[model samples]
Target: MPELRTERLLLRAWQPADLAPWAAMNADPEVRRYFPEVLTREQSEASVARFQADLDERGWGWWAVEVRATGEFIGFTGLDPVDEDMPFTGVEAGWRLTRSAWGHGYATEAARAALTFGFTTLGLPEIVAVTTATNLRSQAVMRRLGMACDPADDFDDPDVPDGPLRRCVVYRISAGTALS
Candidate 1:
């Protein structure tokens, strides 16, 4: 996909040279706290490769986010389809950033752009966001984006081991009301 530029970030595809920084971000315990595990260098490279391929084939994937002024990559954000049997079938918006980029409204900005792409360019009616129950920061971002929590729509994430974090919370926003 083409690069998306925000006031402070450039969201674009990953390059091979991004492996080291991507791996370092993955290795940061704080950054990986919500994920099951920190990805190794090889895994990071593979992930980036897959993301690149997905963008090439589908025209949408998690694009790398970089600082606009310095061109320093910070992390990624994009739209992803939830697996089959998910409560919602449409695309879902998501994001992740390095510790250095946290609390700067970058996640909200990048995610808004992704959601716009999903609802406008992709013509999706609604987009959902799922995260561990304990991931309050992400949940808060969803709310800030005008998504509503559907307590009745909670689900157990088979990908995550059974635990508090495994019981996922879902947030949703329709294209008509995303900016409300």
Candidate 2:
């Protein structure tokens, strides 16, 4: 797996040391607020295992992000293949960070590196981002990454239960677009 570096972060493959913190982050109510539920330690570990396996097989997936200065495991930010059942199927840029990492623009910074890898290294034509309409925090990061939104692209996420979170907005950026 490739390791991505930014001014203050290292987006790399998962390490054994990351398991405990990763689970704790998943269990954080604030961190998992946009999701349907907070994950149990077992569920979080399963997710970590899945992400690690995907990275091993594909050479790219959600990466474990660490703060370079302090060597703290913050969270993950990277690309994922959108599910086939969605109205649009393609690679999506996504991120999740602990509350302590929230206000420092780390998500945008790490995600920019991920987008570069997606467009240049992976030769992807375009990448999309999706979030619940109410997830303004994530949407702001998407815009900061130079992704444009199209209201027509909005759709109800079938995988989410019928609720506010099911109504999702989609944003996209082409491979060569200038990122802010």
Candidate 3:
């Protein structure tokens, strides 16, 4: 995927040098709350490889979110495919950032750019975003992006391990809407 430049962020593919900070963010408990487990360094490397491969195949995925001014990798926010059966069969918008990047509106900014790519570049009719019930922060970002929570679309994530956090709330945003 080609790099996407926002006013303050550079959304692009991951690099080998992003491993340390990326792994650190994945391993952080605060940031990993919605994830089943903290990812190890090896897991993080493998995940980055998968992200790159997905981008190669589909032209987009959870892109590497970076600070344009300092050239620092913060985290990622972009579009990805969901394996679950749902209202839409296309891609979904999503984002994740390190603790330091929280409360900075990076998620909304990067995600809006991703939505533009999904609707304009990929020609997707709509995009979806799912989060655990406790993930109000991400949900708020979704709302700010003009995505509406579809209570009827809520379901337990088939991909989530059998546990307490399996239930999720799904949000939907159609293309050509007033999103952003």
Which candidate ranks first by lDDT, i.e. highest? 2
Residues 86-148, candidate 3: write the lDDT tens digits: 534667788889999999899999998999888888888888898898889999999999999
Which 10-residue window of candidate 1 scores lowest in summed lDDT? 83-92
RMSD to true structure for each model, in Å: 1.3, 1.1, 1.7
Whole-structure CA lDDT of model 2: 0.94
Better of 2 and 3 by TM-score: 2
Q: Rank the candidates by TM-score, best first.
A: 2, 1, 3
| CA lDDT of each prediction against the hidden true structure | 0.87, 0.94, 0.87
Q: Model 3 RMSD to the real structure? A: 1.7
| Superposition-based RMSD of candidate 1 using all C-alpha atoms, in angstroms | 1.3
Q: TM per model? A: 0.95, 0.97, 0.93
lDDT of 1 by residue, 1-180 (tens): 678888888889887667778989998989988878888888888889888988998989889988899888899999887888665687788988899999999999999989888887888889999888889999999998889998998888887876676788899999899745
Residue 96 of model 2, lDDT score: 96
Candidate 3's displacement at residue 22, Å, is 0.7
Greater TM-score among 1 and 3 belongs to 1
Clashing residue pairs in candidate 2 are: none
